[model samples]
Target: MTIEWKGVMPAVTTKFTDQDTLDLQMFEVNINAQIEAGVHGIILGGTLGEASTLSDEEKRILVKTTVNIVKNKVPVIINIAEQTTKGAIEAARKAEEDGASGLMMLPPMRYKAGDRETVIYFKEVAKSTHLPIMIYNNPVDYKIEVTLDMFEELLAFDNIKAVKESTRDISNVTRIKNRFGDRLKILSGVDTLALESLLMGADGWVAGLVDAFPAETVAIYELQKAGKIKEAIAIYRWFLPLLELDINPKLVQNIKLAEVATGIGTENVRAPRLPLVGEERKTVLKVIENGLKTRPELPDYKNSDLM
Candidate 1:
């Protein structure tokens, strides 16, 4: 599948069973829901998917499962958050072998690599695979920003196609467009900044809350792109509270709770990350409940050719 590198590409969460096994049934349910809701692509084993906890075999299974589930209707992108250059290269090759359409790679995990090291790591991984890559430039969480200088150096790799812009500085979208001039596709990685980023010329959104509210998420992107600004803002205003959940430390749990509320998923996460509880749970649930109570009737943005 040729990746368009645009539209609502969800960083979907991985579902688990009570015995702590991959719940393939529920995973399929969510993936189908995302596709039916008009998402352009699906990303597996991302932060929201609990990438660090997953073994290499488990990640491979996810790639195969998503590739099979989407059936080439949308690209299945696997996230590579390895601790070493060798590990990242191996994972990239494995994803391509497992039938992934592309990769969403972060800078080498664990030890923060400097500018030169980061560029080299990404370049080596790029050289190792035929798959196009989207650099996860999230300095705020990962602590090492892939600055413009590094991006300039990286432009030599034809496979380095896009950036998941999570820097949270909305202006960075314009800066990237100015610097690269459409050479690199920009997807807003922050849920809270999604609409603004899209309006400011982001190519797409690598979304978090879309796991549960796939239609609403897709609607916002489609409406914005169709030039229906007023209609998009109406839904985005209602979605703001729920979208903010993506920024929290417990976002996975919060979004899982949402999936439960919507009957699309379960709250069964892996260990070291328990389900939300007490006031945290209550507060999060309150937001979800309120959003549900007043969920807006979506416009027929799907009929627009922008999709």
Candidate 2:
């Protein structure tokens, strides 16, 4: 499957039934909705997808299900969050075996390996699969920056083709472009920074809240790419308050709540995580509600675009 890899590719959340099993039916519904909304790709088993909490079997199932449902509409990229090189290699191989078109790999989780260990981990995993890889560089949350020097080392692996630029340092976007040029596809990983990152040359957005509001997320990206900067900024300014929700630790719960409000998915999440409550829940709901009340109309946006 060929994916443009240059528009909104949501790091979709994993849906669960009340009993906490993977909600395959609802998951299919969510994936189909995203495809209808003109998303350039779909990434499963992301942090937002509750990867760290899901069983290995469940992760593979998510990959296989998405590949089948997506068909050739767009790339199905699976996120691998293992703590060991061997584990990451195994995860990448599993994703490829299940017919995934690409992988979004994080550095070794929980252990915070330094530069040498991190680069080695990515290289080893890249060798194990033929799928194109997007190295997730979220130093703000992951605590290990894949510095430009580190990326220089990664350049040896031809399959290491993209960077999820979530350093939260907006300058990194330009830095990556300056250092690597077209060697890497820089995708903005933070929702609040999506517009800025794009303005600075990010090729796409690996969005979090788009799971709830796919059309708006995609519309902003399309507007910006079309050189309609004023229209894009207008939509992005209105989106900023809600977009901030994706950067917090509670993002999973917060985004799922927005999904529930938007009618795309449920707010149910796995344990060690809980549903939003009290003021936290109310505040997030108000943002979604207020946005819906005054949601901007996309130029040439249509109901059929969502079919």
Q: What is the TM-score of each candidate against the true structure?
A: 0.99, 0.96
Give the alpha carbon lDDT tens digit for every residue of 9-92 in model 1: 999999999999999999999999999999999999899999998988899999999888988899999999999999999999
Over 4 Å off, model 2 = 301-307
**TM value for model 1:** 0.99
Q: How close is candidate 2 to the true structure, as a TM-score?
A: 0.96
Q: Which regions of candidate 1 are displaced past 4 Å?
A: 305-307
Candidate 1, residue 92: the lDDT equals 92
What are the per-residue Cα lDDT tens digits for candidate 2 across 1-307?
A: 7555688999999999999999999898889999999899999888899988999999989988988898888999999899889999988888888899998999999998989999999999888888899999988788999999999999899999999988888998888888899899999999998999999999999999899889889988887877778888998998888898888889999899888888889999999899999998898889889988988877764433432
Poorest stretch of ten by lDDT in candidate 2: 298-307
Pairs that collide, model 2: none
Q: Which candidate tops TM-score?
A: 1
lDDT of 2: 0.89
